[model samples]
Target: MRPETEADLADMIASASGPICVRGGGTRGVHLDGAVLETGGLSGITLYEPGSLTLVARAGTPLAEIEAALDAEGQRLAFEPMDHRGLLGTSGAPTIGGVVSANVSGPRRVSVGACRDFMLGVRYVDGTGTLVKNGGRVMKNVTGYDLVKLMSGSWGTLGVLTEVSLKVLPKPETAAGVLIDGLSDVDAVQAMAKALGSPFEVSGAAHIPRGLNGQPVTMLRIEGFAGSVAYRADQIASLFGGMSVRVERDPETVAKGWAWVRDVDTFQGTEGDVWRVSCTPSDAAGLGAKMKLAALLYDWGGGLIWARVPEGTDLRTRLGAFDGHATLVRGAGQAKFQPEPAPVAALSRGLRARFDPKGILNTGLMG
Candidate 1:
């Protein structure tokens, strides 16, 4: 089922019985047993103000469309949302609604913030087919309950988003990468931490256990005016003077390198279950060491670890208790999301009850 208008969407949900599978672009590899409700029919940008760095678009507006519009204005989505197509092996164009629902974020999240931080407002339909609007087009317009943040990262469990207003940032004038070779996972995490701590404003930090040339590489990214980027890259390189360091100044090369890191390209087309582990930067190495991984990629200055293990591996049980959570991104027979603590689980149940009394939206997807 697809509805082109907001009213039509609300009516469709209002009249629905049994479960409904909410979808946008169908890129996230979420499958549930229910009638499918695709939001693609509700597409297009509603508003864009380059000077104000704000954009409003329907839920199903293609992310490429929004990126193109922002690029024309020398701006971009600061969160640097990842393109999950390659990683998930899905072909549909990613949509703004899916980005928000999943709270998709990339390497730059270490410097800026997650997709939820840039959200200025949101319009969604509750489970009862009621339209709910929260916040507004401007930051100051957000007051009272901040449903905008709650809706993000909800994975469509709470409601079906119809429209979104976002705050964007100006594109950097130039960017550079400082590559340090031959660092072990622990050492790489330490090096990345030092680079991120320095005043050079590292925007992206990642470590590939096995890089393209079959060697471990740690990357630190800096972006700004050309001169600033160059100077900062040199300073970062100097921080690891004893190690083999090379500064990549070519704009295309830097962009491509970061994109590869952001999208977890290393694990693409590989056979294994993928797990995204979120922990403190200091704990990342320890967790990775405990895992029996086939491949690993570290991003967000080692705060996020992507582990590829043999199919049907129960990573959570193997790792035991930890400071953060592990999410199954692919190859799932076990649970996809981490089980919440009893208190948190109760709170989540309460929220779902309030938002979706009928429990018809994306039933059992989160479980």
Candidate 2:
């Protein structure tokens, strides 16, 4: 089932007797045991204001289409949403709905925000077969409940989004990367935290073990005017004096490198279990140290750790105590999402019941 408009989506939802799998671009999702409802037919940009840095588009609009439109206006999605096809081994153009539904964000997320932060408004068809709208095109249009944030990262459990409004940012004049070589994971975490703490305005920070010439490479990114970028690069090098530092000014190469980290590219092609762990920057190294058998890629100045562990290894049990959580991005044995605590689990169930009394939308996708 594919909906071409809001009315069509509502009608389809109302008539459905059982659970339905919601698909957007079909790029990212777990397998579901229900009739598939594709959103690709509901596509196109509704509004774009380059001057205001706002864009409104139907949910099924291709992500590439939105990016091209923003690029033409010298603007971009500040969240730098990631493309999951590479890591998931799925072949489909990513869609705006999928980006929002998954709340995808790249390396720049540490600086700006995630997909939910940029989302201004949304129009979705709820499980009750009623059309619900929240927020608006402008930044200050939050008049009531912030349903925009709720729909995001909901995995289509609450509702099926039909359209979305987003806030964009102007592209930086230039970007430069400071590469510090030969730092161990512990030292790399400390260095990245220091760089992020300083006033140098580091926008992206990542460490790849055995990623560069068989040695650990710590990368710090800064974006701004050419002169500002040059000065910051030098200052960063001075701060980490003992290490080998190289500044990359080429935008293409710098983008490719960050994209690799953002999309978990290192874990690509290798057939192994991948886990994403989020914890305090100071504790990332300690947490990673426990996973001696896993390959690691650190992002967000050590706040986000991507691990390629052996299949069937239960991460939550192995890494006993931690400040944050670990999510199984791709694996066969363990559950995809961490189990929410009892209180939080109850709240989640309550929300799901309120929004989806029939529970006909993407049933069991979140579990």
Taking all chains together, each candidate's TM-score versus the true structure is 0.99, 0.98
RMSD of each: 0.8, 1.0
Worst 10 residues of 2 by lDDT: 24-33
In model 2, what are the clashing residue pairs, if there are any? none
lDDT of 2 by residue, 1-367 (tens): 9888899999999888999999988776467889999999989999999999999999999999999999999999999988888888888899999899989888998888899999999999999999999998888888999999999999899999999999999999989899999889999999998998889999999999888478899999999899999999889878988778898989788888998888988888888888999899999889999998899999999999999988899989989978898999888867788888889889999999999999888897666
Best lDDT goes to which candidate? 1
Task: For candidate 1, report its TM-score.
Answer: 0.99
The clash numbers for all candidates, in the given order, read 0, 0
**lDDT of model 2 at residue 15?**
89
Q: Least lDDT summed over 10 consecutive residues: which range in candidate 1? A: 285-294
Q: Residues 47-137, candidate 1, lDDT per residue (tens digit)?
A: 9999988999999999999999999999999999999889899989999999999999999999999999999999999999999999998
Clashing pairs in 1: none
Model 2 misplaced regions, further than 4 Å: none
